[model samples]
Target: MHDITHRNRAESPSSKTLFKATAIALVVGAGLLVTTVLPAEYGIDPTGVGGYLGLTQLNAIAPQETAEPVEDPMISDAQLASLLNPVWKSSAPLRNDTLTITLGPNEGAEIKAQMQEGDRFMFKWEAQGPVNFDMHGERPNAGDEFTSYWTGRNKTNANGAFQAPFEGVHGWYWHNGGAQPVTVTVTTTGFYEKLYKL
Candidate 1:
């Protein structure tokens, strides 16, 4: 009688129901992967649901031919100090100045600081509109000889530290490339003699 009871339990309907439920779950999971997961994650929409939901844009691939990476070359405050020459010293008082320059469309202007070699300063400038700029230096009497430290295009703000590499003028040349006039406001603080327009 015990053997008969065990045989009957082994043949119960619960095992068949569990098998059917597992099979249904696997089919549903596979359907979701094809209709949703593949389209949203890989931008491959075979069922068209991802495109309708705008999920394809999340992982869309951009054209490689027109993509370019921009790099910022500004140096940090600590690096500016360490780059100064050991023999060069500044006894001048720390000065702060703010100047505004207006440029018409396609016009260019330069403002410089009279600095001796090894003088360090922090400078920040912003434009009312987009402008092109070159941060550079030149000797007092050097004929057409200049050194450019950094340059940027279509930028609205620039901030960085500068250590003079020579006894000369160090500053920026700004060019307004937009259709309207743009004003650039420059602020500087450091061991400089004076700030003047060039």
Candidate 2:
């Protein structure tokens, strides 16, 4: 029987060095992953209850304030009539619908006169003194008779002409400024001639 002596080979120097380097790298990598990478990707909240941070809520906005405007009161029938056909006549009887206006020294005012019932009229003006006249409505056609006789020198003369622009009962209001009392007679001659012959 022959006895054989076999020697166990020692581990190579490069292999021992490689094993130590791999163990050190793995330890350092695990420490970095726990300290930095995990928290940033999936956030770690100290409260342990998870929720979105830096987000806006729908309830944060306040409700808008709204307002409504006020309206004017409706006028009465008598008041409306008075405004539409205003007259200041201090009478001496007989009115086929009479309206009078007394003008004080250099006083100027507008009296809105309307003939709501009739649609075509010949308006006549009889006054005494200096009067500035401007008429509005369907101006009367040519040769349409509308007589105006005043107490002054310009009375009988057809000093002015107003053609009715629209078909409607129309009348005139005048302002007289003279040293004496002036009487004005206004008359409507056409369209159900409700003689406003004041």
Q: Give the clashing pairs for model 1.
A: none
Global CA lDDT of candidate 1, please?
0.90
Question: What lDDT does candidate 2 reach at residue 154?
Answer: 28
What is candidate 2's lDDT per residue for 1-198, written digit by digit as tens?
A: 533345334533577788999999999897555444444444543332232331122223456876664475678889898888865332222223434565565553333233333234345555555654434332346245543423233242123423334444344435445566555545433333334322
- Quote model 2's TM-score: 0.29
TM-score of each: 0.56, 0.29
Candidate 1: segments with Cα more than 4 A from true spot? 1-89
Tell me the lDDT of model 2 at 68.
61
lDDT of each: 0.90, 0.44
Residues 27-134 of candidate 1 have per-residue lDDT tens digits of: 999888877888878888888988888878877867469645547568777878788844555786799999999999999999999998888899999999999999
